[model samples]
Target: MSVPGAMIRCMDLTRFFADVDAQPWADLHHAYGSAADIPDCLRALAGESEEAASEAISELYGSILHQGSVYGATARAVPYLARLAGAGYRTEDLLVLLGGIAEGGADEGDSEEAACRAAVVGQLPLILAKADAEDPGLRRAAAWAAAMTGAAEQVLPVLRLRRKTETDPGVRAELLGAMAHLDPPGTAADATAAIGAHEPAEVRIVALLACVDGGLPWGPAHHAAMLSLLPVNDLVEGRLDLERNEPLQYVVEELLRRDTDADRDAAYTLLDGALRSADSEARAEALWAAETACLLSRSAPERLAGAVEAMVADPADAPAAYSLLAKLGVRAAAAAPVLARLAAGEGDPADRALEALVAVAPDRAAPLLARDLGRRPRALGAACGFLFGGAAGASFTYDPELLDAIRTRLAEAGGPGADEVVRLVNLLGAWGSRASAALPELSAVLSLCPGAVPKALVAICPPEHRGTTAELLTAAARTGPEEGRLAAAAAVRELTGETGPLRAAVAARLTPGGPAVREAASLAAGLGPEAVALVPALRSALSDRAGDRNIPQMDADVEIAAALWRITGDPEEAVPVLAGVLAEVQPMWLRWTFGRAARAAARIGGAARPLVPALEGLLTEPMQIPSAVLALHAIAPETLDGPRTAGLLLDAAEQDADAETALDALVVLGPDSLTEDGRRRLIALAERDLRVRASGLEPGIAPADERLREQAREAARTPAKP
Candidate 1:
């Protein structure tokens, strides 16, 4: 268990075990409930059995440093771990754990995080001594652990000194990475020198990455060195840092960071060359880099599409190729032939290929989906459209083959799962009255799956079938599951505008402790003035503050408030609730509740004047601007400085920061509200080929970008005030 001729000696084991026992371990907290078990886990680390020690290390990682989150117990455990590492009890593993703890806390800046880092920093003298240990593993572990302390002044000098005497290629690579972590700019010269022809490939790979990390100019020599190291994964195996497992990806990401055409071209060239390599691992690595490039650069999808498509020819590479093609959207349309062949074939990856084919070319996928209707759930979901976020393949036009296939699936006994049934009904609903032929199957399944069927029935029901649909909905509203009842009631209202039979059901749902409070509030709001009787129930539900911090509860409150305003037209009763929600909710990015509250406030017009300051405050937020502008325009138009509002909209549009909202506001403001400069910007946005918005790596960015451009053109054509 001990190292021979060890320069760094262990702390006295007797005293270390005593110190560990003295600490109040039970009182500490980790990710899972309590840290009482942590003491036993720590004691096992010093035990004679290596298996016991490994298990203890894993246990500690799961608890105190769970997923890189340092807890109260994390700092207390650090001193013991550092001393054990110094004592040469599993020196490599202990140092790696200590390094993870140190780096985990470095960026978080909380007191617990600071204490964890400080605990490791206290053991620097012992850790640095191991940087030159006789064991290469100890040297590598010590170098990584020391750099993780982020104490550049103390750690960098030791790393630089070790770099000179390091003989093992892996250890040398570790030393180079450690120095680069401490100071990238300062290590640039060392990195450039190490990339010479004589250095080991492992060392050269790390050195090239260090050069890129330092923002050093990448010239012909660096390019030649990188090309010569194609399939460098094997060379740097078990040597490179965890983050740089895929070295080419790191290089291409750094190049793309420059955000210039030349840098992008360089990245594409490197990826293309790697893709053409005969090595499977090399092509796999390049595929990952190509995916990253496509996500970042506007030109990457087109430039790298052919290279990525070539990957599908290899059967092992087909799954990843399908996923990347799906993300590429319309940009990878050229791969449809290959994807179609894979989709039509029978294999585990066949469904994945169909899904990708659906995203890239829905017209081609529709018939295939139709031919294999009962089997492909994911492809069906893709074609039916995502509930959240923009997804392609929802643009499936009226194809008789597809409609007939869906109708056949619906009519079959025990055909699809509950989720698939929902997708099928939703797809039929989207087609509206044109899907009347499927109405008979929908009616038969109404009682079996009442929640989705009622809505679909209302959508596809012709004028002659309205009476029959209303009767079906009314029966379901009267006698079905709570969800079905609410859905049926809503559909009945849509079909016949009668809120009579569902009044008691809506009242019962608004009784504070129900699961369908939000749905009931929405249904009541649809009743408008006819929902006056449920106002007291709504007020009582709003007063229930049991789940006040819950996002869904807050959303229900907004819905109830909107229902109140719609029923009674009382600003005093509703605006305050709307304003309260606006104040309590935050981070408008994902929280649709804040936007919902704003829209409700806008609906009240000038009576929502009390929300003016809050709405005006929201004008500064890119995501909130459209809601704020619409509210301000409704509540108090004089408060809006047209020029300033126009400027903010333009800034949001150009940066793709909530460009959809910004464009909606511009269209609402009309042509006259825009300044001369703003008009010019709007026209330029419409004409530009490079997307002003929707430029992220998501599956539907291409379709989203096209929609934004079309919206911009519409805003440009909007007539000035008469």
Candidate 2:
């Protein structure tokens, strides 16, 4: 009869009473018959007289509890009897029955419940005796049962049997699988000893698979077994089959898919080998898997430090190495000396290493680059370029003393690094707000290197230097060759305002023949009222043929759009212009330009309202999601209500879902709504789904849905664990 879940104790008692009138003697006893069928005949009686049925069942269970203590059959059934007795029966009676079962009579061994209890309390002697019983069935049951009871003492017996006549392959495999459930300290050593005692390849494979499944710390024995398994053969295939059994496959797959510290660290050294397999899809899968592991490990300081160490040791992986260093950020301070050493080298890898170093320890790295200021100018130029390159520049800031030191270095006698010095000058103009004292020195350098100065002056020279810089830039653009005039025009176009000096400078650069003249005129047209005089010139450039570097249409678009917005006080003019160019735009700069235009429209009232729905749709794209969410957050944070967002989150948390995107969305949505009941449900979901999704992830990086399982564990604890 099926027990109703409403109250197991009450139902069991009721079943026993209903069967009292004509209790079947259990005459049809198979080796292991179901204990359930006996109560069937009393089903009608049980419904009519519930109290009478309960009493009869209780009495039967009590008698069974008594029988279980003194007979072999009862010993096998004692755990169930004990459970029945404990449901509503007296606690003292249950304890007494348990004691009697443990102190078995001459014929019967300890009851299974008593043996399991003994295992739980570290009484290994009792379990060892049962495991060495004359009957193989009893030995197997005891060994396996004790394993489930979390006893470590049976590990040795399991190993010893493998060494003896382990003739039955299935029996031997079962024993190895059982060993995987044990977590004792010396289990690996015991498995290794068994492997050594048996010279057969099957035995060795079983031993190695046992060690892997054990998931213990890697000791000498584990190392030996792994090395032996490295060479693939029939034996290796067999061993891998054992390791990839349903349970282990699930565990390894779950571990490989998450971004957890343990998952990342464990797989770091294995991924490269997986990638180099002669399989293209395998290489892609392995690369992505390892990348997932690294992302998960980013928050772990120790793992991040380890990754930095690996990068230093292997400079050949410069791109991957640099990206890892960037992820480490300031936490990788320990890698500073290594970065300094690498920056001192001349190889291209050395340049990459320096960039990675600067990314992590920018303040410290600036000094190293500064100390080697007089080294190879090409390397120096590359270093300075990386320091301020659009890609790596935002990753760091110049410490005050470091910028000062660079300024002082620029004042020193010149060399092949002069181009780099000019680059630094441009950086100061762009970001050197605190380097006011260096302006005189910058002006001196510009004057001394007139040709070099104007090339970068628009980006470097401040307004105080603008008038003088403009004079120099204008004179150079008019008097020098095509390149010099382009540099001058580019410099003068950076300063905004419709002042007399700016107008004169733009006029001088717009002599109307070269690309330099057209670019200057286009920029002048966009510089608001300052560029109103260049309307005719800008229109003329739009019709002119393109050159290698000039963008006549784009330049004219930006200029005309800027001038129209300033003159008419309308932001819509810029939106349509950008919208027209959207299809042909590259991702690298498109969104940034669009964002700027949108922000400008926002400032000029609701000119950007029409684009809100378009921006909202971008939230589902992986790369664009963050920006879209941020924009929405700014516009309407309250729209992400608990019920709606939590439902979205739950959908993402499903096993078939995209885990990385789910995690990202969860981080944005927040977990405020994951209440106690919700957590319990999540745990139940994880338990149901873990078997399927476990194979796709790394071991340590389990799904967030599993948090419910962790909560269930916490709830069931009595005193509560720390």
Candidate 3:
């Protein structure tokens, strides 16, 4: 456990971490406050003693790098650990632990992460040599680590040789799964041999999953064969006792959908048995599989609906059935009649059923909900479910009669059920156009429910009624309930579209100790250029509220920065804060910052150049890439280079996932942006109509016309024309 031994072998460790004897413990962090104690754990892991090493690996596995997220001290710890693995460090899960660290820090786009992998790669020769260790365990561990570090080409040859002579079924199966990644010509054949191997059930399960993942999960016979071999220990992470929990038909239903050409007759035979089974687990899985996998036999929907209809008598089973039906949304329209009965039931069950009815068949359930709202204990929520609470629920607009019904109830149902009236009034505010006739009643609630009046009034009042709305909201912003005051201020700003009165209102609540700081900032953001008057207040609020999460729908810090930029028209004012957020070492959890920061950075131009390294690292993720790509070209257009950026723009355009940002990047990148290689691939992709701007409205696929040709024409307008 002496420091000199590890230091002598891996001298580069001193760059990021302290030595054991002189550890500056107070300054480091390892996802658990102050990592000063980490050096002892590292030393114990380095020692030759097995018991000490076991305890060390267990304690430090997640701490050094928590679930693939790296901390400051994580990179420093990698070299010493790699040295231990290279020098024959022993433990059953040591290779698994090391493999996590290697891949956890595998983000090569960032310098700190690149350094960790670089250190591991330097020790590859030593790690690879361990595959021939006298102990079979060490050899297995070494092979696992090599594959994780992408020494696949190097590791697979050694693994193949070991598989030929290895007697341990567990080790041989592990070798086959590892080899599946590189997928040389005959991986499917090798996987089949492993599946047919006389090994532990867990080992064979590993081989089946590897075969599927290796893109060779062939025909229906293999699909049924894999199902027959289900309930394996490794497949479910040793959590469920699959032998007792798994029913035969449930197994076949799960694996049926995963295969492209699974036998329909065999699948239906198992599913029919599952539907008839007494086991709820089997029956439910079969129903869900039929829906998700597009495996509707002629009788599937009727059998499923009839089963749900029968279950409506049992309150306990009905809600869950309704919830499962809701998973398919409008596709489960066949279950509407049954769902409506449950929606008319009592309490939580009714709420869930109402939600499911909206999802399953909004149009059919609409009149039922409209009539029931006046009588239910929570009428407002039922209305929300039909309005926009469930996915696709918004498309089911209220009938004018429904609006009149809600309006009449809002006024008549005032006194003891004022909260109900309040909720109805709030709905009227949000459904402005649909419920515009409900405004006179919303204004009437001003005296009835003063707390909910201001926002509702501002949000729903006719434009001619602005004078009355401004008066009500101004008073609410000054002295109403804390929740209503902020809502009032926001409504006032949005209603007036003039910042003077809204600014005065928000300013009254923008004090350091005030509860409306976040709302005030939001109002400031919406004010645009008019918010310049509140800069000092925003800056002060941001300082005191650095970690504040009170503001929903946006990150508080990012909003404050964005507000500052909009108000000042000075990129210098906001760029620093946006850059700081963009440059976070672990920005994965702070994804809310990506789009906000990217939009701000794209406006700031050269001010964002220094954060280029941080921005580039986000390219690995699909969700964050569009914004990151925008920030990249905004700061340094030259970094985008050739076809990859061009192709990404085309792909994002076709997908419409983040086409606006991609289109913006193309603009910053200028004309003739793609290199010849990118242009070639792009044209081919568009030829498949993958980059069509408008899907043909008339009928057949869109021809490679002007709109399609433009994608390959202007860099910004360039369709990825194939």
Candidate 4:
């Protein structure tokens, strides 16, 4: 394009040059006449003539030994070419060309080479100084260049400062990306300390990644501080708090990998804190976190003993107790004294103490476990299992005194502890398989105690004990209040594999009218299609009032769906029933059923297609079976591809009260649906959602749904090529 009405026309053009042609400079030779007339060629290169511009550029390239030839002329052209570098360039080539002037004086030591380097560097400084620019792209480019030029001292310090003060998140994030590639230009530790102080989540996150990759030492004290900071509500400002500062996440992992006392102690502290955190993810994380702690502690018998002492002293450190006992499982004999003392303790820590020893007491530890089963009355069902695992049979002699003490507790006025004794006897009957010995005492507890004891007996009792327990359950399953019936049904599910009499006892309880009876029936159905007889009762229970109060019934419906899906492979059996429940059920329960149905249906392969309409309807409502959409998306993404699907999503986005719900619909519709009008609407909704999330006032339900939608969108965009 040429400038209009100018004495010397200035034109800007883009073209490629190749050396493969015989007369590679044909255009230049044809325009400028010869290579000797370089001055006129340089003037014409700035003019509108394309041929002159080519010759001028080529002559400038050829002059390696001159005071002021085409090289110096182009040196004055450096500012003009800098914009091209900012746009996009073969950056390494550009850097090398610039470096030749700055470092090597590559133009044969001519003053022009010096002048060219000065001019390029002068232009480059403007770009470098703007690394802290408010514009994200400019800041990103500047930071990239600064990194490329080895901005160890000057650029890093400015980037670090701007990382703290910059308000524009994108700019801050880009600067951080640039900052991560460069060393901090001092002691690695000092550099980490400097960058770690930056503010806002974007920069701090990058700084953390950098610090982690930079190989900083993260010992016990460092890791403990980080663990304290978890369950973070704010990522940036929250990090600045000394309480929130921890060794970097990667550093902690590396510490775990190394064999050292510092690592072991840090791992122990982290596991203790993680297990106690209110967050479920954190709790789950704590389980694996102990692996290295266990290894590094080298099954230390003394340390295990110390942990027991600490637990006994504090009484509040439950995780520490569990950790100590779990670790002791590896030190079977060394743990005997601690387990015996804990099993015998009659003090405030007694309940906790028993819980600790139940799993750790060895095969020979069975005697200790068995002794406690009769004398120390707490968590009896658990104690029975310990006895079974420890001393498996009639081989171990039982103390009559201990058995008598249990019988006395059962006969006396019962507190919560008395019930614990009955549960213990049931456990013994279940595992010991000696129903003949305990039947009298077990029947008495079933007849006299609160309903829970008998129900537990039904669950734990072995095939031999099932005979009497089944008789008890059948007689009482229908007669008790709703709670008793549900309890009876749960027990029936547990005893499903016992003798014919017990199986029949469970079958008889799968009756109509009561949610408890139906729930038990559903559970029975799950055991096998033999209990498919219970399906009629389950189908009828679906008509029962579906509300928050009917949690058991909702639970029964899912079990019924799963049961039906398992037996018939009929989407017909589950879909209509599940859809009916979805239509009338409480939101939470409905969500639960939808998720179950979707999973079950998906497991049955394309047999789930009929349920897609219902799943889609719930998905449109946001958080209403969100997991189901993923199943549908996986099985039938094409269903969401049509215009009708787009229209439905758009309608949902507009009509829904929750911004997240609408955002999710837009995301499902995908970027292809973003016409100018649609784009504007989405942007507006996004801004509103952002504000709501920022203020902590919006419900996360819809936003969480949008996150799922975002994940789906990203998955769809990834190409198949490796």
Structure candidate 4, residue pairs in collision: 226-246
Clash numbers, per candidate:
1, 23, 7, 1
lDDT values of the candidates? 0.80, 0.46, 0.59, 0.47
Q: What's the alpha carbon RMSD for model 3? A: 9.9
**Candidate closest to the true structure, highest lDDT:** 1
Show the lowest summed lDDT stretch of 10 residues, model 3. Answer: 696-705
Error of 1 at 590 (Å): 9.3
Lowest summed lDDT across 10 adjacent residues in model 1 is found at: 387-396
| Over 4 Å off, model 2 | 1-257, 260-297, 300-302, 306-330, 337-368, 376-414, 417-422, 426-441, 444-498, 501-531, 535-559, 570-722
Q: What is the lDDT of residue 69 in candidate 3?
A: 62
In model 1, pairs of residues that clash are 10-87
Q: Positional deviation of 683 in candidate 1, in angstroms?
A: 10
For lDDT, candidate 1 versus 4, the one ahead is 1
Largest TM-score belongs to which candidate? 1
Candidate 2 residue 455 C-alpha distance from true site, Å: 10
- What's the CA RMSD of model 4 in angstroms? 24.5
lDDT of 1: 0.80
State model 3's lDDT. Answer: 0.59
Worst 10 residues of 4 by lDDT: 15-24
Which structure is stronger by lDDT: 1 or 2?
Answer: 1
Q: Can you give the TM-score per candidate against the true fold?
A: 0.85, 0.40, 0.60, 0.42
Better of 1 and 2 by TM-score: 1
